[model samples]
Target: MTDHGPTREELPFPDYDHLPITGLAHRIRSLDLAQLRVVIEYEEAHARRVPALQVLQTRASELEAGAEPSGGDPSALAPELSPAPSAGSSVSPATAPGPDIPPTESDEAKPPMRG
Candidate 1:
């Protein structure tokens, strides 16, 4: 019988090199102090890579210590680049309402249907 070598389907390691490090760093930087702790815990459990873990741990510590700038602050090394909401804007009606369907006009006070 001929020996059948392991196929690519049997590859043991997942390819992480292709992951977008810059994008991840931006997201991590945006996390609040509490959320950052959760992310750090997840990183420790799964990937556990030294360099990446170090970066996350350092940022988390800085946030916990109140030494880190807010993610949106331009002074931050990796500033949050997400768009900012306009000031004094009310919450949009669609999202403000709960998952339940909103009441129809019939449910509210209405002038009797015009002829």
Candidate 2:
């Protein structure tokens, strides 16, 4: 709790960079004031994610104003990534080869020089 060097991954919120506003709203309800403050500062320095930041700041204020932390069900949260398309919606690599496409084994496919 007192550790000062918290990173985005270390935050209680999963996928902090990508959590939806709704998910953030639900998750932050369980964090104590100190935790909420850390989230706010992390968001500000990283993406400056306004919606999540506003939600967290507001909750932190509520706690400062004497509200108690209401622990929420962390397991119920869903990932921000959308569900993958079912089988037919995607093209299999084995079936999609084109004559113009270079072979993956060729030296020409090597990555460009970075230096």
Candidate 3:
């Protein structure tokens, strides 16, 4: 296949090389078979990362066997990957409350733990 200059940056995850194996599998759930093939070809041609290629190949097989894409929306993240939250009422951790701040007490007024 003539690569014609398609780069890793053209992938759904431009940082695909940086993704952990588990993360790669997770992100691949958002891809259709065609998109998956683009990645597999890219990996074979340029980076040639064996582990990643295996994952892509496995997933592509599953797709060929009639498994459906998670229907994950591939537009909500990574500027290219768009995995939408599966539920309407999903509360992302980004929207969750942070740690509670302890009330400030005057240093002199605080009782010491020592005897």
lDDT of 2 by residue, 16-97 (tens): 6666788777777878888787788787777777777788888988999999888675434566556556766456777786
Candidate 1 residue pairs in clash (backbone atoms < 3 Å):
none
Better of 1 and 2 by lDDT: 2
lDDT of candidates 1 onward, in order: 0.53, 0.73, 0.76
lDDT of 1 by residue, 2-115 (tens): 133333222221122223455455555656766555555555555667776777788878777786544463123333244356787676886585688876987777766688
The top-ranked prediction according to TM-score is: 2
User: Could you tell me which residue pairs clash in candidate 2?
Assistant: none
Off by over 4 Å in 3: 1-5, 74-115
Model 2: how far is 109 from its true place, Å? 56
Cα lDDT for residue 17, candidate 3: 61
RMSD of each: 17.7, 12.9, 10.4
- The lDDT-based order of candidates, best leading, equals 3, 2, 1
**Candidate 1: residue 61 lDDT (0-100):** 81
Query: Where's the lowest-lDDT run of ten residues in candidate 3?
Result: 73-82
For model 3, residues 6-40, the per-residue Cα lDDT tens digits are 57666766667656666688789989998888888
